[model samples]
Target chain A: MRIIVPIKQVPETTNVKMDPVTGTMVREGVEAIINPLDLYAIEAAAQLKEKFGSKIVTISMGPAKAEEALREAIAMGCDEAILLTDKAFAGADTWATSYTLAQAIRRIGEFDLILCGERATDGDTGQVGPGIAAWLDLPFATYVSKIESIQDGEIIVERMVENGYEMLSMPMPCLLTVVKEINYPRLPSLKGKIAAKQKQVAYWGTAEIGAQPNNIGLKGSPTRVVKIATPQVARFGKIVQPKDEHELNRALDELIDMLKQKAIL
Target chain B: MEYKGVWILGEQDEGRIKLVTLELLKRGRALADKRNVPLTAILLGEKIDAESLKKLGHYGADQVIVVEHPVLRYYLPEPYLNVCKVLIEKHHPEIMIASATTTGRSLMPALAVKCATGLTADCTELDIEEETGNLIQTRPAIGGNILATIKTPVHRPQMATVRPHSNKPLEPDPQRQAQIIYEKVDENLLGSRVKRIGFKANPAETASIQEADVVVAGGKGFKKAENFKMVHQLANLLNGAVGASRDAVDLGWAPYAAQVGLSGKTVSPKFYLAIGISGSVQHLAGIKTAEMIAAINNDPEAQIFQVTDFGIVADLFEVAPLLIEKLRNHLPDKEA
Candidate 1:
């Protein structure tokens, strides 16, 4: 089996801060990491490799810096790494982004499975995975938590629904967006780290993938961001807490009174 | 092709219709009246009850178009998409709406691609432009830092999937009625490529935090998984459901279903209590609709305190026992 895993480089969600005056993202200290959810996809792919011997080719769509994300995947026992980057690919939305990825997948033909993270933390829309499947016309599943088995030209898995899970069996040449519960990601071993250092990262651009000019970038995106504004987070109401015992009793009384008045008790 | 009516994709299971679908039906009603078009609901399921049908009418649907099949009972996108694709191509409604759920999100984007249309996901606000008659879709983006208003200017059947709890369902009027249109589904097209073996509901789903009026959420300040028991204990005392910040969930202290954040479920509860949580915008976005928020964190400048109405600058471990003891003493029999 030939499995292709798509990974992304995203801003460290915790450290992201908005400039109060300019309302622009302050990306100074936000270190880039392989999207947290994609780690599970990598782990799932490695588990499959261990069970059934196969080659793992990891792909990423970002600037040259995204090569680091690909290298990290190589350290996790991926056989090959492909980085799709170009000035033309900037500002692409999910639809255009998926189109670019589909072109790259076409370039890396003869693949049995395409696996990706459930969603990116920065862009939580989760549209890219399904959008890619649509572009490539492959059966796909999102929020996949468990892989039951790989049997007779198909893969069985459990999809995470609202409060439960459903067992689905799709043919082998499919795409999957996995959740964190899929597997526990393993740490890169010393041998794997050295292999990552020696790994050759292949870089592809629009011309390399033979992508149409208009359908590869911002020009191809259907939706337009007409406006962007920081959501105002003014405190809801006054904060009330007691300073001492007397105040504690008074605060408790006031709370009970308010609830009673609201008929919530 | 003339785009005419307003369409709402009413999602359902065997017997019950989803709350988000009813919420969309209510909104669809107003949009239909504004455009002077009939509001139609397209439902796909094995068996949909009359109560669910009436509720759809009660919320604002004028017509209910159903595609029934045994395979439709479990959602696999292929069949639902096939049924909806055919109906949409034939009807060519001006606007189409579906709930942004596990099912809707999976189905809509593919269908949108199939129909060569545009779609907006997890929208917090939906409106129509008076002059252009375009759908105005607004949603929080870039980790809830900014709200972006997007428009699909050229696409017909302007489509969107709204966030689940963003809108409330209108009161169901049993007296209301709908013209139920049953469309025959092509059995051969349904479940051809992908197959569903079985499905089971997680028992924890029954205690849905979105439905809880009071949510007691904890963060990494709980230290470890074992110390997290106090959160549940406090929830028990308050007659509330237990919630978790993404940090707690990431640390494996709580289940993903309990996670309260942008990537997880949005909650609009009456009273929300945060313990040891330094509120990130991602977490704060979900609870923004919470009526009353209280925070207990040792850090006086913890961001959680900024959003809540009541904030206590103290160790949560110490505060937990005191609040529990006081609540027990104040009202022994009180439920909420």
Candidate 2:
């Protein structure tokens, strides 16, 4: 079996904050790390490698610094890693990104399965996996939580939905966008980390992937971000602290009245 | 080729049209009227009657399109995408909208790619540009720290999957009438390599956070899983759904379905009560659309207070029981 995993590097969202004075993102200290959800996809690939004795190739499409994310995946048990970086890939929307990745995957030749995180924290689109599947004419599933079996050139998995979970079976050479419930990602081994450092990472660009200039970057993107604005949070912030029992009673009465007025009671 | 009409990829559940579909109709009506074009609602299911199909007209569909097949009963990506592609090729709609549900999220991307069109997902704000009549889509990005407005400048049939609960459904008008069209397509387009074998509903979820009008959420301050009982009790008293922050769900105190945040569910409830949540940017993203918010925490300076209309600084243990008592006493006799 040959399994491919697509990962992304994103800003650590927890540390992402806005500067009150400028009303702009405070990007100075926000560290870029592997998208947290993608860890589950990597772990799923690693477990599949452990069980089926297959090779796991992890791929990422980002700036050159994204190589660090690929190396971390290798430390976590990926057999090899590839980085697709180019100035032409910049400003690409999900469509362009999916087209570029699909082109690279085509260059890699045959593969049984591809795994991706449910969505990236930055884009939050969750569209690329299915978009790639469309480009490749492959069957795919999203929010996959469990892989029940993989045999006879087919795979059965459990996927999460709003109401519950659905068990599905798809042919080989399929794609899955996994949820966090799939597995608890494993920590990298010290020896694996040392090996990852010594391993060479291959860098691919638009030319290497043979991507069409019309569909590889900003020019290829169908959608454009015309404007960006911060949402203004509006709240009264009516805070009250009652130190004594009488004060507590008064506060409780006022709260009940407010709730009543809102028809929440 | 002129893309000419507004279309809603309508959804139905258990033979009845879903609320989100109606919500889209309400919003789609405005966009269609602005562009001086007809609005169409397309329904795909196994067995929907004409009576139910015509009801879409009452909600603002100038035309109704129906495609019924046993294979189309359940949503599978390939077959659905194939059928939608065929429809897009035939109709050449200018704008298409769908709910940002699992079904839409699964189908739209593939459909957009197959047709080589642009689709924006989870759009909270949508409008038509005055000059070009392009659909303007606005949605939160970077965990709600910034909102980006996007547009498909050069693609036909501009598509978007709108967030649920962002708009209410319009009032039904029995007087309104629509032309209904039934389509029959090639069987080969319905072929699929995937099969859905079974479905199991999440048993632990007593109420759906997305559908709830009131959400009572707990955070890490509860300290222990058992402490969630009070949160549940409060939710029960208020007739609300139980919600949790990522920390609570991560610690196994709550199920993932009950989590509300960037990685979880986005809830636009009429009222949200945060218990001990510090309101991370991701967490705030989920509830930013809520109509009213209140918080109860021991720390007066908790970040949650910054976004809440009301804040009470006190021990949750004391506050929970007392608040429950007060609500029980004040609730009308029939409600209590």
Candidate 3:
């Protein structure tokens, strides 16, 4: 029942603002926290570890600062942590990112399951998890809401679709991208926090993971951001203030007329 | 190895083409015309009827490629990935587009990784670069605070997924003719370790907010869960769908399926009504494509007011009941 959870450290994207003149993200003072969704992955792993009495290892690939997110995973009950940090890993897209993670997972050897958050907050693309599964050639499921059972050599789960929920069964040694509906993550325990403080996280670079020089960085990423722009926020801003009941009815009539003109009602 | 033609991975349900696929065909037709290449629709399913295949041509496809297999009857990543990889290799396409639905989101990324190509997710805009003939993909980033335009400089069949409802399908023309091709592959390519066991439909969901023409959303200012009834009432009156802000969903006042925001679901209904929502950027991200938006809140300077077409600075409690009563009385029963 050994499990692997991939986590990410992301800026509070809600707090990320755009400079009006430069049109670049103003990230100077924004605080970085664990991707809110990844906590669910860590929690799913922790719940399985408690039930099966097995180990849970958390992994992350980013700048050295990402180790703080790994340590937080330990505080939330992951047994160990690994940080894949290097200057070479910069500017990797989902493809290159997943390739490096697959190499790390190969180095970590065998595991029963790999769990990841549905998507990272910054990129908002739920591709890396499936990308990793493709690289590793493992069966995978996305937008999983519940894990119904884990029997001999197989696991059953429910995944979301357009209209309904589809129940699926996949062999062990598979991957899953979990949604927020999975479970409410538990807070870090005092004992777990003490252990996390003492746990020495292992940091690996491209060389240690035997990653191909061309496949671990900007050169390996097929997609490039050619331009970035702040979206213009424009509104009609028609306002109506009704001080009394009669005026309120008048306003309502006007609103209905607009709806009728738009053919929305 | 020259890449040519524009390919759209058409989605099918029970052997019928989905609306999203038709919408992609509309965009694909334009890009192909611009590039002077043929627009091809790739359909994979079991027992697809002839009429369904002909509809692809009517929409815009110059060629419709069909790969029928029982395993593909339902979407599992392994088999679909295998089939797509083989087809992509056999006939190199310059560009490929898919709808950012459950199937497309699941399959395209895995296929892109296998092919070692670039893929942009949930792109709102796509165009051909005049200089390099590259696909210019634009998508929102960091909760719609910014947009990033991406390109695949060295990859063949540059891939992207557009969210459903972001675009409309073109008018069908039955006079159009399309050449159809059927492909056969090895049985081993269809094997999969994952299996679908069952499907559970949500009967209580009368209308999906994603496909609804009108949406009535409520936020945290509603105070109590019971207050959501008014939101539902308004939606019911309009025969629309009810939506909830992230705050409302987090407070257990509404289901996550009804939640609209960066983390929830993106909706592009024709008309949207926001009540008590202060319009965080994340929530606004989901509804930015909505044709018209109207907001009601007690606060005069709420951020929602900045993006809405109509703004009412008043208490929602009084407004909701009054609006409901007025509509019920003034309109015919069926219309209301």
Candidate 4:
């Protein structure tokens, strides 16, 4: 069996900063980590590879620096890595993003399964995985919590839903977007790190993947960010101190009355 | 104005139509009415459930498109997207909308890519442009620290995914009527690699948060796992639901299903009480749409206060019991 995992590099939640002038994230100088959720996808892929004697290929579409994330995936036991990077890919939204990724996957040829995190930490849209599945015209399951079993032609997994979980079985060559509950990612070992350092990362651009110029970048993206600004903060409530038990009860009653007046009771 | 109609992506689960589908139909009808265009719904499944299709007319769909096949029973991205693509390609609707449920969220982005159009996810508000009749999508951005208004100025069909329950579904008129168009499923395009074996549902106790009306949410300030019971107790007293900040859930104080954040469930209810939460950007992204918010924390500068209608700068451990007692005394005998 052959498995492909898509990973992303995101700004550490704590260190993320917004530029006041552009209303965009300040990516420079910020620490980039393999999106925490994608680690679960990598782990799931690794587990499958270990069980089935499969080859694992990790892919990422981002700036050249994103190669670091692919390296991290390799260090976690992936067999190979690919990076889809180009100046033309800048400012692409999820739609354009999934299109580019689909083109890249087509170039990579055939695969038995594609795995990804439920959503990216930066965008939090959880669209790309399904978007890829849609473009490639494959079956997909999202918010997968556990893998029940895998047979020659079909795979069974548990999908997390609102009321409960549903176990779903889909055939090979399906795409899965996983949540954190799937498995804990393993830390890189010394031998794995050495292999990752020596491995060369494959690179692909828009021309190589046959994506239309208008469909691969900012020009291709339909949605535009008009303006970004800080949300206005509402005033804080004034604390009311009670002098005695009678005053305390009265204060509490007044607060409740106020809430009722607001129709929030 | 090449595009000129509204489309709703109808989602089905286990032979039943999802509530979000009805909600999207209601909203789609209003948009179509405002623009003086037809409101069409597209339903893809294994079999055409007549009972569910009939409800679409009541919910305000002017036209219903059904694509039924045995392979379409479970959500396969290939077949479902093919149906949507075929519908959009044939009719060229001006706008498309979908509910921001798990399935919709997963499918819409991919569909948008296939259509080569833009898609705004988790939008809290959707409106039509008076001049162009294009959809104006309003959604939280920068981790809920800012609300961004997005527009696809040059696109033929403006698309968006709305969070569930953000807007109430209109009352079923029963008087409304619509046309039903059945489309053939393309079996050749369907991938042979994937097949559904069986489904096992998750336990009920852990899954209740999705249907919760009044959710009592706690954050890192709750101190320890034992303190989470205060939130549970308050929820039980009010016959409500329990939620937790990403921090609390990450610390194992609550189940992952109870996590409320950008990466978790986007819930909007009549009443939401946040306890001991400082309100990180991700956490706020999830519940900022709640109609009424009450926050309790010892920190006077907590960010949760920004959107909260009422706030108390007191310890949650101290305030929770008192609040429960007061609610028990004042609330009506039956649950609202």
Model 4, span B85-164: residue lDDT tens: 77788889989998887767877887887787889988877888899666888887656657778889887688899988
lDDT against the true structure, each candidate: 0.82, 0.88, 0.89, 0.79
DockQ of 3: 0.68
Clashing pairs in 3: none
Worst 10 residues of 2 chain B by lDDT: B327-336
Give the per-residue lDDT digits (tens) of candidate 1, residues B307-332. 77777666777777667777777668
Ranking by DockQ: 2, 3, 1, 4
lDDT of 2 by residue, B1-336 (tens): 988999999988656777888889998999999999999998888887678678888999999888888888888898889888899899999999999888889899988888888989899999999998999999988988889999999998899999888777889999998889989989999998989899888764445788777899999989999988888877877788899999999999998888898888888887899997988878988888887788888997676776788888888777877877777776645232
Error of 3 at A244 (Å): 2.6
Error of 2 at A48 (Å): 1.3
Writing each residue's lDDT as its tens digit, candidate 3 over B1-336 gives 999999999988888878888989999998999999999999889878788788789999999999999999989989999999999999999999998887888899999999989999999999999988999999998878788999999988899999878888889999997888999988999998999999987554434678788889999989999998989888878778899998999899887778888787888888899999988777888898888899999998677876788888899999999989877875667443
Cα error, candidate 4, residue B66 (Å): 4.5
Cα error, candidate 2, residue A134 (Å) = 0.7
Local error of candidate 1 at B258, Å? 1.3
As a whole number from 0 to 100, the lDDT of residue B193 in candidate 2 is: 92
The root-mean-square deviation over C-alpha atoms between each candidate and the true structure, in angstroms, is 2.7, 1.9, 2.0, 3.8
lDDT for A229 (candidate 1): 74
Worst 10 residues of 1 chain B by lDDT: B202-211
Per-residue lDDT of A78-180 in model 2, one digit per residue for the tens?
Answer: 8889999999999999999999999999998999999999999988999999999999999999989999999899999999887788899999999999988
Backbone clashes in model 1, listed as residue pairs: none
